[model samples]
Target: MSSVSRTSPTLATLPVDMVKHITDYLDIDSLWNLACTSKVFMEFIQDLKIRTGGYHVDIQKGSYRIELPAEHYCYCNWEEDDDYLIDDLNKDFKDFQSLFPENIDFLRIDPNLVRNFDRFHQECTVLSIGAHPMEYCRFKAETCPTEKLDLLLNNVNFRKGLALNGPKPLVTENKKIFNIDWLLIRNVTWITPEFIRKLKNKIVYLMGTESLTEKDINEYLKDLKSGKIDNRNLQVIGFNTGFGRPRYDREQVLNGLDTTQVLDQTYKVADYDKRIESELFIGTSSANGDIKIFRSFDFNRDDGTKVSVEFMYRTVRVYIWNQDKEQEKEKVTKKRGHAKDTNGPAAKNPYSHHSSPPPNVYNCGVSRYLLPGNIDYLLIDPKIAGKFKNVMDCAILSIVTFRKGLALNGVIPKMWKIWNIDWLQIRNSSIPIPLSMLYNKIINLWDISTITEPQINRYLLDIRDGAIDQPNLSLIQFRKQSGWNSQEILSGLGTVRCQERKIYKLKDFDEKMRMDTFLPFGLDENGIELRDTFDFVRRKDGVKCSVVLLDWVVRVYVWNQMETKKRARGHPEDKDTNDATAKKSCY
Candidate 1:
């Protein structure tokens, strides 16, 4: 006789949906029970869409997180259990990879009587995440079932920092997430520009958003200037749209906004001392002048508050300043960095102009916001240029060597040389200004005007023959007068042409610039972007340089970057040269 056998149905045998409903009633111990039962159960538990407290547990982040509490994680009773129990548990902990090495001791200790409740509890708090990975409090999945994130965030104090990183899209109706001490949101593309207009966080950084437009940035700045949005607690706020995106047009962002240019080294924002700029741009110094590197625009409010708008390659930062004003006690937030020295007054970088803005101090190294009272930044009066036998070490942004008098009160003007002047404007100046003026100095960009075509020709020829050797000079320009010949400038130089076709962009600040001319004001403003170029090799060191000869100007681009040299495909000698980015890196 055959007997029919009946088998008991377990979670492993049941549908995955049924398994989730059963686990819903289970505690942390129940989870371990199912996970430790067998290989099938372990994977079954892993696949369940369970979110205990803060973390998704579904995945992880490359970012660092603070500690969460360990409320329900009690010590295990290893009396009858084999070493396999602890082994599987340790293996799971290691898989998370968030646990500290010192906190995990199950593997190194004896299995018999090693379940110390107190230490295990402490370790669990370190490993177990609840509200968020970096939050202060802690809880076990058994304590609270998976619920809405808004409800979870609603219960959190958030005096501590907050970070959201989950693979799934978050659904939160709560508006409170917008205002925190410090916050970081990964995959923040869902965030709207409307949300940005309401940001009150002290330091907020939002990543992975392709929807935020430059127009949004312009409106935000306008609001700040109009007092439409005010967050006294706010210190640093930035939006970094990934690379190759449209640049945050400075002219558009600060359009019609009354701004105060900060000339002093300190760009004070409540004395918070968080040097976020340096932390983000750590790789700044080694970089050549391929780009503008740094530029800032600041303004003061009717309420006496100061605001700074800084624009970079493809990113933007808004800094609110209340120098003597204080805010609430600081909380744990994403630390961009801290100021190098804040104890005393800032020391003037003696050689600031001669080198790359000293690493970590690019903020200070960028030319001051420019004194509003000193609007003649372009024209360095010949009288002032004659004062410093050597002001080489000074943080002089641009020099104007026009035939005029300079007004300097403190130092008592004497005699000076043109040393380490970054943006140089020589009005009514000649090609031969004495090698002493250019020798061993860092002059990255130069604009000379009112010079004859013959003089410009002689200068280019001398540069090729090793007669005019300025290693640190990256680019120099000679503006053409009415009678000048553009054709002669391009053909006279022994040169080569590159293949890449492109349009030029020297549009730094606003669009009100005259598109064709390089006026004296152009030195302080922007330069003409269009150009036709030829390459030349310096006889001295076999170094190559690019010369952009335009109908209106003649520009000699030296210190050609190795990347450009290798990538610059040669075109037919008959074809006009391809392109060159303004502010090409210096030697």
Candidate 2:
């Protein structure tokens, strides 16, 4: 304790900056070990920055820098001399030689191992041949001893050729060799018949617009037949042929294929517009015609390109043929009937005096009703007359009759109770007794259970007389009963007779005589002036039995009278005529 001790500076005792610089070159594992040795050294080593090839490392301002090969560094024990001499040394050497082949570069091995290095160089190329001057300068700047350069250089394998020993035997053909045929053509543009022939043994991927015309298709088929093009082993990836939009037709294309045998292989044809229509045609039409007319030979290839070809027209025109010879005979018969009507009697006036009358009596009866006259005698039963008390009530009643000894054959009498005398006059003067009612009444009156043929004929004659304005009666009701056969009724009417001993035939009547009539009464003075009534004298077997004034009144006259007097008036014109002709007309 009395003597002064001389201090020996240990690594730990070294300046903080110096220790940092020393640990900078150490591997990551070694640096970590060093940091655990002491607090001061721990901080120093922990703060050091170390970077490897192509990698960056960061550190604090006071930390060290380490440049080392990452693959060669065993970072766990950097400070151990045995680890430095064996593990790191061999690892750096192996890593250095791996960067170059032995034949391309030479290694400056130890003099004792020079012979072994020469043999190794003959077989392999050296990765790196000389000392790295840049690495040496870096170490020198950090105050590393120049002798360290020699130690670093020993790890490298220097090539004799790189060292000015005259280029070492060239390493001929270093890359791997492969057969060219093994390579495949992936991108295809145009595939010709010749190209297809050459690829008989190889797999070919086809794409793009390979449009073939009818002629071309035919030629291709001919070639196939003559063995010009080889189609064997041909595997098409994407094959398409069609035309552009609006012009594309698939029917023509398919028709061309049908005629020619070009595609012996199963090639998928798609984006075909014409093909769809062709299939529809085959389904709808029975004609075995070519599909050229319906669709255009338009198609698209695998690459979305258009292909087209023209096809010859082979459509079969279907005509409707009449094989029956009797059709002509029927036509001749129809012509004869038409000619008879066109050139027959009364051709100039088909509706002449011989023409049939209208079916309904209303039109003519209304004409008679509108004639100026006055009501003289109201033919009605007293019991029926008592029913109408109110004017409105009177308008609702109607006069209906059923005549016996006719087709209807039943009891029916004309009876009425009504208001609105004007409406009654209009209706009474228009509608006639229905034939069915007449037939039914006659059967009831004469005690006849069934209508005889003559009775049926009589009812029809009465209906016809009213319909034609030949009789004073009006045929009002004859509405066909539900489900009643018109043809059967016509057939019955064709062979019926009337009570007056007159025969009635359906052929004797025309269409007008079978239809109801609608009369148009005029509203003008000219029409009003035409209004007149006549006296009807009934004579049975040449004896004067009854005389009656056919009283008529124009609607306008009633309306005028109502307007002037503010009340309805009877037919004055008919009354005047009735008074003047009563003595001569009345029996």
lDDT of the candidates, in the order given: 0.42, 0.25
lDDT of 1 by residue, 518-562 (tens): 222213232222233466777777665666543234566554333
Model 2's lDDT to the true fold?
0.25
TM accuracy, model 2: 0.14
Clashes of 1: 19
Please report the candidate that would top lDDT against the real structure: 1
Candidate 1 Cα deviation (angstroms), residue 25: 47
lDDT of 2 by residue, 62-111 (tens): 22112222122211113224323343434544433332111211122221
